[model samples]
Target: MENKTPIIALVDDDKVFQLTASRTIKAAQLTDKILQFENGEDALVFLKNHASDSETLPDYIFLDINMPYVDGWMFLEDYSLFKTKLSKPIEIYMVSSSIDPRDVDRARNNENVRQYIIKPVTREKFIELLGKAAA
Candidate 1:
């Protein structure tokens, strides 16, 4: 990935959302390495390995709340365990198709999560996330 473009880790169980988000992000030209995953479990595995590698980890992660097996919330709980591995707090954004107030409320309280945004992510929001990651 280029140093100029931000890297984003996109975790969602839905294949459609993952593909759409990845396409939209690249279409906006806001990121270079926009990793896609079908579940939070695999995403977490990748995150762990990436953090251990010498290379810099992803600057941002877009997490989906509703998924089979290890959901986004569970991932967050586990992510906290690896908090010490990071030099700074990794920017995480909750992206979901559901509009549940409780889900939004829960995500807001998580210090690692920066935003709780509804899916069908647009160029503007994607760009905004890139700015946050860069900051």
Candidate 2:
């Protein structure tokens, strides 16, 4: 059996958010590795480059809607092209601070999006998400 720890990717530009989210995920024992990306572009690059490698690709991606460049929307558009190329199925959760109903509707309409979560993701939320993913 393959002994690979699940990998989680946080695609956001906020430094403080990344730090806190990483800490919470670690504290919650969600996964062994957490990959941080400053923008969606970087995350997409890594995913594309490692599309054929299940062990190298992230199992889950928490995407933020706003950023300097290649925001979550753009990332979703681009990712749609390469989604089928991935060797492993990756669960994507659109995590944003926006309370806009449009944003929520858009995320929910997307077939690839597993769920949309608000900001300041709590340890309990992490547990629920991770547990559901495992199931």
Candidate 3:
């Protein structure tokens, strides 16, 4: 029997965070492919390009609030407009190093956001998230 792995998308400008998160996900045996984008613009482009294909759409998205072009908030705004056209539902999680109460409140208030996580996502968190995703 072949095990199917989930596709995870990481939208962040921090190269170190991407690398660390990718490694952590792999180490946790959560996912094999971690599609990375340096900014929300690139991630949005990818999503738009694959909107019609459910097989190509990401199962999970880890979005950072800050970036050079098209921050997470902007992406969310645009995504709200584009989501209705998509073939599948994407589970989005707001991940950032920011500990600001405003950010947490904002993420919590967003209907599309599943959860808010701090940076350096741990293996345990990945396992928990993966379990939830499977459910």
Best by lDDT: 2
* Clashing residue pairs, backbone N/CA/C < 3 A, model 3: none
Residue 67 displacement in candidate 3 (angstroms): 0.9
Which lDDT tens digits does candidate 3 get at residues 16-130? 9999889999988788888999999999999999999977889899999989979999999999989988888899999999999999999999988999999878888988987
Which stretches of model 2 miss by more than 4 angstroms?
1-4
Q: What are the clash counts of all predictions, listed in order? A: 0, 0, 0
The 10-residue segment of model 2 with minimum total lDDT is 1-10
List the candidates ranked by TM-score, beginning with the highest. Answer: 2, 3, 1
In model 1, what are the clashing residue pairs, if there are any? Answer: none
Per-residue lDDT for 47-101 in model 2, tens only?
Answer: 9999999888999999999987899999999999989999989999999999899
Tell me how candidate 3 scores on lDDT. 0.90
Q: Write the residue-wise lDDT of candidate 1 on 1-135 in tens digits.
A: 355656678888888887878888888888668778888899888878777653456668899998999999999999999867865456889999889999999999988799999988888888787866666
- Which numbered prediction scores highest in TM-score against the true structure? 2
Candidate 1 local lDDT, residue 23: 89
lDDT of all the models against the reference?
0.82, 0.93, 0.90
